[model samples]
Target chain A: MKVMVAGGAGFIGSHLIDALLAQGDDVVCVDNFFIGTRENIAHLHGNPHFKFYEQDLTDLDRMLKIFQAEQVEYVFHLAANSDIQASAQNPMIEYKNTYSTTFILLECMRLCGVKKLFFASTSAVYGEQMGVEVSEDAVALKPISYYGGAKLGSEGIISSFAYMNDMSVLVFRFPNVIGPRLTHGVIFDFVKRLKADPTHLRILGDGTQSKPYIYVMDLVDAIMRFKDVEKGITLYNVGVETQTSVTRIAEIVCEKMGLPEIPFEYTGGRGGWKGDVPVFAYNLDKIHAAGWRASMTSDEAVAKTVEMVL
Target chain B: MKVMVAGGAGFIGSHLIDALLAQGDDVVCVDNFFIGTRENIAHLHGNPHFKFYEQDLTDLDRMLKIFQAEQVEYVFHLAANSDIQASAQNPMIEYKNTYSTTFILLECMRLCGVKKLFFASTSAVYGEQMGVEVSEDAVALKPISYYGGAKLGSEGIISSFAYMNDMSVLVFRFPNVIGPRLTHGVIFDFVKRLKADPTHLRILGDGTQSKPYIYVMDLVDAIMRFKDVEKGITLYNVGVETQTSVTRIAEIVCEKMGLPEIPFEYTGGRGGWKGDVPVFAYNLDKIHAAGWRASMTSDEAVAKTVEMVL
Candidate 1:
C-alpha cells in the first residue's frame, strides 16, 4: 500500500512512519517543519520505501498536485498545531494549521479518488467536561480552547467529506500523548523548566488539574492496528484507562531529575491557560472493545516519558 | 439596550429587528446586502431608534471598531450564506460567510467587551439523521453539506468563545425558517419554479424528504423572549413539533398558487443537491423547557408563507 503521513517528521508521526514501514507499506512523509523536525525522521534516509516531501499542507493546488502525482491511496493526517498556549495569542494559527489543512486534504483526496483517512483528533474536542471521562457518542461536543475549536472544526469538516465524498474515516480522539522525541506539552515543559532551574518549578494550573496521558508508542500502535471497517466514520478515544494529576507528574519529574522536594509554585487556576481543559479524560471502552488497549497507565506513561526526556 | 443585529436586513434578521424595536431597544442593523435587501428593512428608515450599516461582518477591524464605538451590548449574529445548493458549488462561500463571519464576530465582541451573543445556527448541523427529531444534546453532530459543516464549525467557534471569554451565549439550531421576506429555501424554490412553468413542478429529491419548518415570526418571538439565565453557553433547537414532507409542501404550494393538478417531476435520489439531508428534523424540547414554543405547525407555516409570497 502506498500511504502518506502528513506531519510525519513530528514525534508521533515519525513513530507512526516506522510502524507503517515495518508493515511493508511504501510511505511518503510530508512536513512543513513547524513542530516537526528533520532530526525526527532522519533515520529513514537510506530506506527505499521512505520518501520525504517538505511543504505546507494548506496549499490546495500543491497538495492536489502531490496527491495526483503520487497516486496516494491512503492518508494518515497527523499534521496540526501542537501548541495549545499559542492559539490564544493567534486564533488563525490553529484555524490555518488544523482546519484549513484538513479541508485541503479532504478536497485533494476527493479529487484524487483516495478512499481512506486516519485522523488524529484530540480529547480537547470534549473541552472542559463536567465529569472526568467523556464517551464518544455522549453530550454536545464543545471545544473551549482556540486550538480545540479548530480541531473540532476540522473533525466536522472531515466527517462532512467522509459522508459526501464516499470515503471511510477513523477519528481517534487522543489524550495527552507523551513519549520520546517530545516536542511540547507538560512533560517537556517540566523538563525544560527544571533543567534551567531545579530548585523551584512553576506549574501552569493549580496542582489538582488532572487529566489522562497516553504514550506516543501506544497511540502509534493504535493507529497502525486500526481495524478498518467498511463504514463512513469510525471514531475512538485512544488513551490509557486511568487519569493523572499535575502534582503527580511534577513529583515524577523531580524524582527522575534527582531533585529532592522541589518547591512547586502553581499559577492558581482551574486551567493551565485561557483555553486549557483541566481534568480532561475520555471513556476508553470503545477502543478497548475494538481490541486495542494501552499497556501503560497514565502515571506509568508520564514516568516513562520523564525517564525518556531526562 | 444598544443591540447589534448582524445581517439585520435579511429574512429572520428583519423580523427579529421588529421584535427588538417593539421592546424599545436601540438597534444597529448590519448587513452586507449579499442575500439581504434594502426593501426588507426599508420601513425602519423613519424609526429613530434603528440604524442600518451596509457592511460585511468578516471585516474584523471594521467590525471591532463598530462594536467598540457604538458601545454594542448584545449581538444577534445572523449574517451567513443562506443557499445550501450554492455551497457545494463553491465550498468556501459558506465557510467564509458563515464560519469566518462568526469567528470574526466573536473576536470583535471579545475585543469590545461585549458580554452576550445570540448565534443563529441550523439543523443542518445535525446532518442526515435516522430518527425524525434529534435532540440538541444527543446524536453526535456530523454535518454532511458544506453549508452544514460551516454552520457546525461556527457553532463550535461560538461555544469556545462563550466558554473562554467570559461571555454568555445562546445557540438556536433553527430548522427551515419560512415566512415573508423569504430570500431562498425549498418553498421559495417551488414558488419560483412553478411561476416559471405552471404546467409542471420539478422537485429536487424523491418528494418524500421530511423535515421541520418554523414561522419566521415564531423564531423572532423566541429570540426576543429568550430567558436570560446566567450561564456560559445555553443551547436550544427552535422549530415546530410536527414534521413536514417535501410532497406535502409541493401540494400546498400548487393548491395555494392556483395550479391545476400539476405533474410533480422529481430529479430522483434522496438529496435534492449534494449536501441536502433527505430526512432532516430537530427536537425543540430544550427551548420549550426554557419557556418558549412555536406558535404555528410546519404545515401552517408553509401555507402562510405561500400566501405571503403570492
Candidate 2:
C-alpha cells in the first residue's frame, strides 16, 4: 500500500511511519516542521521505501504535487498546533495550523482520488464532559478552548467530505498521548522542569483535574485497526480506560526522577487558564470492540514518558 | 460613541451602520468587499461622521492601523463568508474567512485598547436541534457545516478573550435575518428565480424544513439594545419568536410578487444541502429580558423581505 503521513516527523507520526515501513508499505512522510522536528524521523532517512517531503499542508498546490507524484492511496493526518494554552492566546494560528491545514489535505485527497483518510483528533474535543466515561456516540464535544474548537471544526469538515465525496474517514480522538521522543506533554513538561530546577513543580488548576492518557504506540495501533475497519465514517475515543490526576502524574514524575518529594504549588482556578477544560475522561469501548486496547495505564504512560525524557 | 463596523458594506453590517449613524455615533466602516458591496454604504459616503476603509481583517497590521487611526471605541464584527453550501464544499476558505479573520480582529482590538465588541453570530451554530426553542445555555454545539464550526470557534475565542482580558463582548446568534439589501436568503433566492422563470420555484429540501426568521431592521434594534447592556460576555438568540416553513415562505413570495401560485418542487433531502441545518428555532427570552424584541413574525419578515427584494 502507498501511504502518506502528514506531520510524520512529529512523535506519533514518526512512530506510525516506522510501523508502516516495517509492514513493507511505501510511505511518504510530509512535514512543515512547525512543531515537528527532523530528528524524530531521522532514522527513516536511509530506508529505500521511505520518502520525506518538507511541505506545508496549507499550500494546496505543493500537497497536490506530492499526491500526484506518490499516487497516495491513504492519508494519515496528524499535523496540528497542539498547544491548548497557546491556542487561547493566538487562536488564528491554531485555526490556520489545525483546521485550515486539515481542509487543505482533505481537498487535495479528494482531487487526487484518495479513498481513505485517518484524522488525529483530540480528547479535548470532549471538553468538560459530565460522565466518567465518554463514548463516541455520547454528546461529548463542547470544546472550551481554541485548540479543541479547531479540532471539532476539522472533524465537521472531514465528516462532510466523507458524506459528500464518498471518502472513508476514521477520526481518533486521542487522550493525552505520552511516549518517547515526545516534544510536548504533561510528563515531558514535568521532566524538563525537574531537570532545570529540581525544587518545586508548579501545577495548573489545583492539580486535581483528571484525564485519561494513552501511550503513543497504543494510539498508532488503534489508528491502524480503525483504518482496517470497513466503516464509511468512524470516530473513536482512543485512550486507556484508567484516569489519572495531574497530582498523580506529578508524583510519578518525581518517583521516576529519583528526587525527593517536591512541594507542589497550585494556581487556584476552575480552569488551568483561559479556555482550559478542567476535567475529562473517555469511554474506549468503540475502539476496543474493533480489537484494540491500551496496555499501559495513565500513570504507567507518564512514568515511561518521564524516563524517556530524562 | 465611536464605532468600527467590520464587513460594514454587507447586509447586516450595513443595516447596523445606518442605525449607528442615525444615533449620532461616529462610524468607521471596514470591508474587503468579498461579499460586501460598495452600493450598500455608498449613500453614507458623504456624511462627515461616517468613514469607509477597504481592508481585509485577516491582515493584522492593516487592521491595527485602521483601529488606531479611527480611534475606534467599539467594534461590530460582521465579516464572514456567509454561504453555508460554499463552506461545506470549501472548508479551508470558510475557516480562513470566518475564523481566522475574527481572531485577527480580536487581536487588533486588544492592541488598540478597544473595550467593547459586538460579534454577529448565527443560529447555524446550533446545528440540527430537536427542541422548538434552543436556549443559550445548551450543553453541546454540534455544528454540521464548516461555516457553523467557524462561527462557534470565533465564539469560543471571544469568550476566552473576555475571560482572560477585561474585554466586554456581546454575541448575537441571529436566525435567518432577512430584509432590504439582502444578497442571499430564501426570499431573495425565490424572488430571483420567480423573476427568471415565473411558473416554477425550486426549493432545496423537502419543503418541510422550518426556521426562525427576523427582519434586518429588527435585528439591528436588538443589537443596539445589546450594546447598551453592560456585561462581560453575553450571548443572545436574536430572532422573531415564530417559526416559518419553506412552503409557507414560497406562498408569501408568490402573494407578494402578484404571480400565480408557482409549483413548489421538493429536491427530496434532509436539509437544503449536505451541511445545512434541516430545522432550527431559537429561544429569545434572554434578549427579551434585556429589553429587546422583534416586532414582526417570521412569516411577516419573509413577506416584507420578498416585497423589498422584488
Chain A vs native chain A, TM-score per candidate? 0.97, 0.95
Each candidate structure's count of clashing pairs:
0, 1
Candidate 2 stretches greater than 4 Å from native: A85-92, A126-144, A196-210, A228-233, A245-247, A261-279, A283-292, B85-92, B129-140, B197-206, B228-233, B261-274, B283-292
DockQ of each: 0.63, 0.25
Each candidate: chain B TM-score: 0.96, 0.96
**Worst lDDT window (10 residues) for model 1 chain B?**
B222-231
- Residue lDDT tens for model 1, A152-210: 88888777788778888989999788888887788888989999988899998898988
Worst 10 residues of 1 chain A by lDDT: A222-231
List the pairs of residues colliding in candidate 1.
Answer: none
Q: Write model 1 residue lDDT over B1-310, tens digit each, in one string.
A: 9899999999989999998999989999999998999999999998999998888888888887788779988999999989888777667677678878888888888777788999898888888877656888866988888878888888777777787788988888888898999978888889999999899998987989887888999998888877354558888888888878999999999999889599999888987777788886677777788778889999999999999987
- Candidate 2 lDDT, tens digit per residue, B1-310? 8999999999999999999999999999999999999899989978999999999888988888888888888999999999776666677677678977887887787677787999988887776767646788764565667688678767766754555457788888887888888888678788889999998899988988888888889989888876854646777888887889888898898888887656888888878778777788788788788777889998888888887778
Misplaced by over 4 Å in model 1 are: A45-48, B45-48, B227-229
In model 2, the clashing pairs are A134-A283
Best by DockQ: 1
